[model samples]
Target: MQDVIIVGGSFAGLTAAMQLGRARRKVTVFDTGLNRNRYADHAHNIFGHDGTPPGELLAAARQQVQAYPTVQLVPAKAQLVSGGPDDFRVTTTDGETVSGRRLILSYGIVDDFPAIPGFAQCWGKTVIHCPFCHGYEVAGTRWGLVYSSPMSLHGAVLYANWTDDITLFLDGHAIIDEERHKLEKRGVRLVDGKLRTISHDAGRIASVTMDDGTEIALEALYAHPRNRPSADLHEQLELDMGDTPTGTMIKAGDMQATSRPGIYVAGDLATGMHSVTFASNTGSLAAMGALQSMLV
Candidate 1:
């Protein structure tokens, strides 16, 4: 049996492998090759590697981790997880079973895109979620906030730091007087109507159209859609889950240890602050936790 089996080979998974690999711990990483930031053109806010393409960053990471003799990378999906500490069994989608002493779940979450024309097309470009990731480029440009929930109100205020020309699209949701006063105080324009379509030019948004034939010109749109874990192994393993403002995530402790022994979780699957740097940090911590467990 290997020392550990890490599912998902994106930022979190590769970082975890790097940690255990350095310690000469036998580790096998199963990756379906789907990363949450794959849609993004370039990753920002990541120190040292800012402005690099997500694919390029991960490619470099994969190459570096291969130097360790104990690390093995497999291009496959982990179908199911069973067994317990030091005796866990992982079955791949191809029907191959692998046994490991510990398991690290770094599979990121899947985004639930809105069913709006040009919305998906503009995603990762003109339409984005986090301002910290894409706000700088479009600073001082016309910005629109597509309200998904009350939680989005905070995003509207935050985006103001990048641009004062901000408009909040209610999208048929009723806004109370208090919320309206707060938004008005921030110099945010509130638009109330059902969104019909987003007109764009080559994946770049030009205007947001409402069902009532109202058109609002915009350069960029911000939205926070609900997401779920990329894989369903958590259900099979019966791991404890916690709710975040965005979606459900595995509950992990300070060491990235899940409620279930020998199972550690990292990345977007465990926290709401989704970023490449944070994911890498959690992956390192989870790997260290796994190593300590094995040593004990």
Candidate 2:
């Protein structure tokens, strides 16, 4: 059996593999390679490699991990997960079964965008998320926020710092009276009604169409998507999940160990805030933790 089986070979999984490989522990990383940011043209806010494409970063990371002889990288989705607690097993989509003394799940989250026609097509482009990641590029442009939850107001406020031309689309959701006042005070226009669609050219959103046959000219739109963890392997393993203000996450400790013995989690699955840097760090931490646990 491998010393550790790291599910998901994105930033987090690779980071973990590097740490374990350096320690002379055998590691296998399984990845489907559908990272959420795959569509983004250039990743921002990440130091040292600012403006790098997500693919480039991953390719470089894969090369570095390959430099370690003890680490094995497998490009396949985890289809089934079974066993547990120092003797866990996982089956990949291609029907390959793998067993390990420890499991580190760095599988990222899944994002579903609004059904608005052009919205999905514009993702990672004119329509986006994460101000710190993409805010500066479109700063001071005509910006719109599609309200999906009450918490989305917080995103809108942050976007305002980068652009004065900001509008909040209720999108058939109720906007609290007090919140409405605050939005107006900040010069954020309020649009109410069901969103019909978005219009764009070459991946750039140009306007937002409402159900009332009114179109709001816009340069970029912000949305908060409902994200679900990619692998449901947790259900098969019956692992404990912790509650967070936003949603539920795989239960893990300071070192990323799960409640089940020898099971660990990293990246978005184990944490709330999603950042590329955070995922990379957590992956490495989980790898080191698993290696240490094996020694004991």
Model 2 C-alpha lDDT per residue in residues 1-296, reported as the tens digit of each score: 88899899998888899888899888889998898899899998787999999999999999999999989999988889888667788899899998899999988888877677988899999888778888898898999988877678887787878999999999888977999999899899999998898999978998988999999999888887777778798878888997543456898887988878888899989887788999988998898888888888
Whole-model lDDT values for every prediction: 0.93, 0.87
lDDT tens digits, residue span 1-296, model 1:
99999999899999999999999999999998889988889999999989999999999999999999999999999998999999999999899899999999999999998798888898899999888999999999999998888787888898889999999999888979999999999899999988889999888899999999999999999988889999998899999999988789999997899989999999999998999989999999999999999988
* Clashes by residue pair, model 2: none
Clashes of 2: 0
Q: In model 2, which range of ten residues has the least summed lDDT? A: 242-251
Clashes of 1: 0
Q: When superposed on Cα atoms, how far off is each prediction in RMSD?
A: 0.9, 1.5
TM-scores for all predictions: 0.98, 0.96
How good is model 1 by TM-score? 0.98
